[model samples]
Target chain A: MGAIYKRELSGYFNSAIGYVVLAVYYFFSGLFFYLYCFYRDSASLGYVFANMFYIVMFIIPVLTMKTFSEERRQKTDQALLTSPVSLTEIVLGKFLGAFTIYALCCAIFLVYGVVISFFAQPQWSVVLCTLLGMLLLGMAIIAMNIFISSLTESMVVAAVVGMAAGLVIDTMSSFSKLVPIPWVQFVLEKIDFLNYYTNFTYGILSIVDVIFFLSVTGLFLFFTVRVLERRRWS
Target chain B: MIEVKNLTKRYGKITALDNISFTVDTGEVLGFLGPNGAGKSTTMNIITGYISSTSGTVTVDGSEILEEPKKTKQKIGYLPEIPPLYIDMTVRKYLEFMFDLKRVKLPKKEHLDEVMRLVGLEQHGARLIKNLSKGYRQRVGFAQALLGNPPVIILDEPTVGLDPKQIIEIRKLIKSLGKKHTVIFSSHVLSEISAACDRIIIIADGKIIADAKTDELSGVLTDKRQLLLTAEGSAADIQNELKKIPDVQKVKKTGESDGAAQFAIEYKPGADIRRDVFSAMTRLQCPILEMRSGSESLEELYLRLTGSVKGGEA
Candidate 1:
């Protein structure tokens, strides 16, 4: 697991993907900070966090599109599968490899928080809560996108499908309003990802919301492992 | 060192391997000989635990592959049909990653350097795999299989794209590896198998058609003995004289050179008709120039066993 994680993490930097992901992520975060906090003469990070939904959706797929799909496409999965490592370890190694990059991207927000602190007393509780929210959301999305990557050999197809799935999940509540049936609408609103994330943005670290994100992450990771195991039989 | 029993694999409606079973003893080089799509890769894949068999089990060193994958996989090294290399990594880094992935306990630097030297990749270790040629990529793959020094090594067509010189070098490497490891090598080329393996398993259409010692396979397949004779005489006289031997089943005039007639004589398997033919030629005042016994070559045996020959020509 450690070996795979190290190789995968280095693989991102070996190409331009790691640096590009960081650059794009930092650029968007800086833009949102400038427009929402610096230009507005306010120190609140809530507006910046609230507007990051689309950026997170777009960036997570790019971060994870090559996790397993590249391995499958290059036939490198044979070496990993035939090695002494278990399937669970391989999946976790890949998940954490991408998660580490996303975590680095999130760290930029801490820098922004420090910069805001120089001029005014920013709300530390809200800032930490929103950061936790972003990390948890990233965990679930990375797991889900990694699962999508495992289903196909083409990295392009993985990225496209991953983006599509993220968009639908992120906008489930808005789509729920369009449904005529009350029960279906109620269920979609209940499962809406943004609804759970709203609590963290308002300085409320709800246990139920944390569990929801963790469960989603675990469920998708389990599904990824099963998909890889099923491919052997295939 | 390895045993496969009642192994069967099916890709949907297609049966890739049909109840094929074989075993390799310790310190033996076993070759899987077949044409393309003959379940050679399928069997190796199952043994290496890269894929699962539909209804079968592979036991390596007394541990079942599926039930105890890590334990069994630790005991064997596999080189698949495609060498499973990361193109972005330098040869040294790629091998080091494999070393760590396999969890080998040996001294990493010395072991990797020795493997690189073994496969003639010592000079190319610092180069990226993407810049290396196909033969060099194959050598890197071969070096990976030798990393942990596992007791059992399974290679699927290890010399597919190499030139003739490199092919011979790989063959020699396999021969040397057999001394320390139980090697299961698969190849579609007939001479490659015959030259390297102690025992050969001929698979065709998802079935094991023939399994015998390399030399004994050819011996067992030659049921009808043939003798080639060249005598200093007219073709008609040599043909007529050859017909007088009772054991001679059929005789055909092949060619003539320097007033010598060449005749191919097919005799019953148990009979020794050389002395009779020599005496007949001596009685006819014809000196026998060349005479040699001919058995079915490995190529003919492979062709016949794989059902490529038609009308019993083999």
Candidate 2:
């Protein structure tokens, strides 16, 4: 698992994907930071956090698209699967590799927060809470995208499907409002990931929301493992 | 040692491997001879735990592969039909990654250097795999399988795309490795198998058609031995004289060249009729120019067993 993790993490940087992902992420986040904080002359990061939700959803699939898809396309999965490692280890190693990159992207927000601190005293607790929420949300989405990547050999298909799935998860609450059926609305509200995410932006660190994101992350990682195992059987 | 029993693999309605069972004893070079789509790679995949067998078990070193994959996989090194390579990585880095992935206990730098040297990749270590030729990439794959020095090395068509020189080098390496490791090498080439393996298993249509020692497979498949004789004499006289020798089942004038007759003599197996033929030729005053014994070549035997050629004894 350690070896796979190291290889995967370095793989992102070996090609242009890692730098490209970070660059795209930083450009958007920097633009949002300037618009929400500096141009407006405010210390609040709530608007930047809220607006970057959709950007995170779109950008993360780029990081996770080639996780398993490239390996399958190149037939490198034979080496990983046939090695003396379990399915769990391979899945987790890949998950953590992607997660580390996403975490680095999120860490840029800290520098943004520190910059705001010099101009005006910001709510550190609220800022920390939003960062935690962003990390958890990124974890869940990265895990889900890795699962998408595992289902196909085409990285393009994985990215498109991953973005579609992310859009679905992010917009469930809005879709629920449009639905007239009360039961469907209630179910969508119950499963909406954005609802849980919105709480942390306002400094509400609910344990239930944390658990919800963690469960989703774990569930998708499990699904990725199952997909690999099923391929072997097939 | 490896033991595969009752192995059957089916992809939907198509059966790839059909109830095949075989075992490789310790320190044996077992060549899996088969034509394309003959379950050679499928069988290797199952034994190496890359895939699961539908209705059978593969036991490596004492444990079932499916039940204890880590333990079983540790003892076997597999090179699939396509060398699974990361072309973006340098050859050295790729090998180092594999060494770590296999968790070798040997000193890392020395072991990797030895493997690179063994595969003749020492000079190309720093080059990206994408830039190397096909033969070099294959050597890198071979080096990967040799990383941990596992007891069982299973290579599926290791010399498929190599040039004649590289192929000979790899065959020699495999022959040398057979001295210590139990090797299962698969190929469609008949001479490659006959030259490198101690025992041969010929598979066709997912069935074991022939299995015997390298020298014995021809004798096992062919019931008659033939000798081609060229002599300066009348064809009729040569055939008549050759038929008089005991165990000479049939003698036919095959051809005439430079006014010399070429007679093909079919004899019973295990019979030495050369001395009798020589004496008869001296008595008939038909001076012998050339005489050579012929058995079924491995190529002919392979074609016959694979059902490529029909209605003739190999």
Q: Where's the lowest-lDDT run of ten residues in candidate 2 chain B?
A: B305-314
Judge candidate 2 at residue A137 and give its lDDT: 93
Report the C-alpha lDDT of model 1 over A1-234, residue by residue, as the tens digit: 999999989999998999999999999999999998989989999999988878889999999999999999999999999999999999999999999999999999899899999989989999999999999999999999999999999999999999999889977988999999999999998888899988999999999999999999999999999999999999
| Candidate that would win on DockQ | 1
Task: Supply candidate 1's per-residue lDDT for A96.
Answer: 97
Candidate 1 B-chain TM-score: 0.80
Candidate 2 residues A1-234, lDDT tens each?
999999888899989988988998899999999998999998989999988899899988999999999999999999998899999999999999999988899899899989998989989999999999999999999999999999999999999998999889877988999999999999999889899999999999999999999999999999999999999989
Cα interface RMSD of each candidate: 0.5, 0.6
The 10 consecutive residues of candidate 1 chain B with the worst lDDT sum are: B294-303
lDDT string, candidate 1, B127-191, tens digits:
99999999999999999999989999999999999999999999999999999999999998877
